[model samples]
Target: MVLQRMGSVKVASATLVAALAVVFALTLMKGTYSFGGFWSTEAHRNRSIDLQLFDAWSNPTLWYAPWLDAVGNVALFIPFGFLLVTIVAGRWRIPIVFSTLLGFLVSVGIEVAQYVYAIGYTDVDDVVCNTVGAFLGACFARILGYRGRGFVVTLFLVGALCVLAEMVLSVVF
Candidate 1:
């Protein structure tokens, strides 16, 4: 019975991971889904990288922009870390570090793609925000306790709730 439950948890974890991948792709590469060529033919591309960390604060009128973007980026990857830790069996540090590194690499890749495809501009702030988000997410997973049947169940429930919230928000807006 225990083995059967574990197997089911593993299956659920895999499914959640797959769903995450799809959501991530859709969210990041939304511009690619438009009816256009493979590469954007825009004459101008934003390749400049803004190293100014607090520049987002300079705009007094849009004060919330920076805060929102940072928080949103972090919130975006929390699930990635949580789900990753739940699925992988290892020390807490392993998943935490792995998730952080993965988040950074993925963010960098997305920035590069955005620049190359002329879909969006690359920003160092985004990379920093994403990494921090992933780190927090990993910490959250650790807080929930790592690598157990209960943890797996909790992860699935939390993920489902998050998905439901997202769906509700999308429908409302």
Candidate 2:
């Protein structure tokens, strides 16, 4: 019975990871999947990379766009970090560090892809924010005792169901 339950959890975790990967890809591509060719590469080649740190503090504005963007970037990776840590809980000696590094690499890859595809500009600030978010998520997962396979499976199911419901509702309404 225990072996059967573990197998089920593994299956669920794999499914959740696949779903997360799809979502991440769609998000990084801005929901526009293409196979013909990369669009507007030359036009965006001259775009300047912004390495400025603490942009919100450097230019304090009432609009709050920068702040919101920073927060959004962080929020975007939290679930990814949480899920990653939960999936690799028992196997990894330092799951939090692994999660943070994974987040950094993913963020870097996205930034590079954006620059290459001309879909968006690259920013170091985003990498920092995303890493922090992943770290926080890993910490949260540890606090919640997600080392157990049962808890991880339950969490994934609940999250997946919620996301599905949200998508359905958005389409219906």
Candidate 3:
């Protein structure tokens, strides 16, 4: 009974950590809401500026030089993937289907938030890429968790790495 209780607590903690990570990312990028949640719009530059992927992809300059830009965008949402896995599987044990759906919701939420806010724009590619990023991170966490890893620890570590990386990008680039 004690062990079961401890496990449950760990799972809950893991999910909370992931949620907080997402909030933190939002806070750092954009000036959030009046009530204190990380405002996704804080990261937006223009209200409805469309970053069409086809246009971006067509540019040869973006192909190799902006690796950091791509990483920054994708890494920004790893926590969502991490959190979805933790929530559905209880310790990073989520199945592919569950991860996919949750990833989709999160990506959609982000895109919608961007559309609503005057700063950010709604882009389908952002949604697709963000979901893919989260999915990859979740898969990594799930694999490690199978060997008795604690989801909470994974959550904290992943969040920390992302935070640090973003800081570097913001400072240097």
- Which parts of model 2 are misplaced by more than 4 Å? 1-12, 15-19, 22-27, 31-48, 60-62, 147-173
TM-score-better candidate, 2 vs 3: 2
Winner on lDDT (2 vs 3): 2
Worst 10 residues of 1 by lDDT: 35-44
TM-score of each: 0.65, 0.67, 0.60
Q: Please count the clashing residue pairs in each candidate, in the order shown.
A: 0, 0, 5
Per-residue CA lDDT of model 2 for 107-160, tens digit only, reads: 888777767666555778888998898898778777867334445555555665
Most accurate candidate by lDDT: 2
RMSD of 1: 6.7
Candidate 3 error regions (>4 Å) = 1-45, 49-51, 60-66, 90-94, 151-173
**TM-score of candidate 3 to 2 decimals:** 0.60
Q: Give the least accurate 10-residue stretch of model 3, judged by summed lDDT.
A: 32-41
RMSD for all candidates, in order, please: 6.7, 6.6, 7.0
